[model samples]
Target: MAFAVSGYEGGKTVDFRRLAHTGIRLVGITRSYRDGVLSFEEGLAKNVADGDQAYFDVLREADAYIEENGLPFPPEPGAWELLPDPDCLTNPILSLDLAAAGITTIIWATGFKFDFGWLKVNAFDEKGDPFHKRGISAESGIYFLGLPNLVNRASSFIYGVWHDAKYIADHIVLQEGYMSYAKP
Candidate 1:
């Protein structure tokens, strides 16, 4: 009875219809947005331009259903009203609180980029920007899936993530030489 939907305007709007047609009752939907600046439509447009047609279609459908049924966009009660703190430091704690309040899981579909500025580790490229070599981050357990130049010029694309993911998986299993390894 559980149905997963991404947070985006066009694709989610479309996917919701398919779910409704399949007789799956809409219990809830999670909103994945950074800083609440980009709307669902904006996210979908970015995905479409990036050639993520599959994701774009899925989100378009789901959002349509929500609008048709007069259901709230996020579907989760109080989600829209909750404004994140300006400092952004409250995010993790707020997420934990939400989980304790009955949210079983969080689907974070947001795109990625370097956020290492906050970390004390001096992990960056020659230009002082965070460098993701082979999708491995300087921080342990933190890996970058889609980043340009990881394998090739277009390694940030979806197909490239698969190849990069393999290397990450292998490194995790064979942690002897991996820099991310640490003593328990």
Candidate 2:
């Protein structure tokens, strides 16, 4: 959604792909369309979470049928501008005069947060993302194999999960590391 709103422009760590419906400013073609869409959704989740912006990316795109009827999702918050300083309150903009400021509108991006309350391990960070290296989370022998890019872009796909599962099984056959963490 951010990418779409940015008209495919990138940020410090972000990269954009052009949308045909949006405009012709930029275009990103990928070898696999499905993968690209999946990656976009994943990046959307991450970016919204990282920015601590209101997450209504569920409105990233309206269903064709729905759009035809005209549903107004609250407009997305501003193209959230990050300040040079980390203290968000210090630089709050108390007022803006549209004519004097040459501004058109204000959109407030409400941030999103993930909940890991059901997980058995103490692995999530302050932001609720599990701490991981490769596919391995902080909890010994526990793997977040189902997450996107646990080790690579394909990590959460069927093939990737199968490959990772096989590797885990092989390791279990040769060593008892996973068993050590398994309840006896």
Candidate 3:
């Protein structure tokens, strides 16, 4: 199948044909319609473990939705290919060596629990989350970024991170009285 990623204005307008809702919560994993108003399978309210069955269930639902809505399929046709081993999804062995691959940075985005112990800062709450006001902590020279609702609802989104970063940067520059140097 052909695939393309495009951007659109975000609001009430949702292109359900191109999207599916899937999430992993503390309760369990959930895969459903984006609006959650529709269910392809009966009794989909309960969470299930992430596995091949759940993955296929979602694909089947999406296929049904597309067919039911008379949405056009990709022009190209190809047989669906399954991964050789499902275990690779969880424990993927890297084929590329970072040093040989000339990789400088790796963003460890494990989407799991947060561990702030290495921060060595006392600016955290009892729950261990950083205690900050729009990324600015009580302790000077320390800041946070890309956290949910850090400044607004979009704080964690890619489209919103720059605003948060700029806010923090401006705060740092102003607080350090660097504006005097820029006056020329």
Which has the higher TM-score value, candidate number 1 or candidate number 2? 2
TM-score of each: 0.30, 0.34, 0.42
- How much does each candidate deviate from the true structure in C-alpha RMSD? 16.5, 18.1, 15.7
Answer with 1 or 3, whichever has the higher lDDT.
3
Give model 2's TM-score versus the native structure: 0.34
Give me the overall lDDT of model 3: 0.55
Judged by whole-model lDDT over C-alpha atoms, candidate 1 comes out at 0.49
Count residue pairs with overlapping backbones in model 3. Answer: 0
Task: Return the top candidate by TM-score.
Answer: 3
- Clash pairs, candidate 3, are none
> Which consecutive 10 residues in model 1 have the weakest lDDT in total?
86-95
Q: Write the per-residue lDDT of candidate 3 for residues 2-88, one digit (tens) a residue.
A: 121126554322222222222221111223324322123322222222233444454677688888999998622222333232232
What is the C-alpha lDDT profile of model 1 across 1-184, one tens digit per residue? Answer: 1122334563342343343346532322233435432122223223222433444443566677888898866654331231222222211122224433465564665345466567566457776576667777677766666666577534666645788888899987777555555655
Instruction: Give the distance in Å from residue 147's predicted Cα in candidate 3 to where it truly belongs.
Output: 0.1
Give me the runs in candidate 1 sitting further than 4 Å from their true place.
Answer: 1-115, 137-142, 176-184
Per-candidate Cα lDDT values, in order, are 0.49, 0.45, 0.55
Error of 1 at 88 (Å): 40
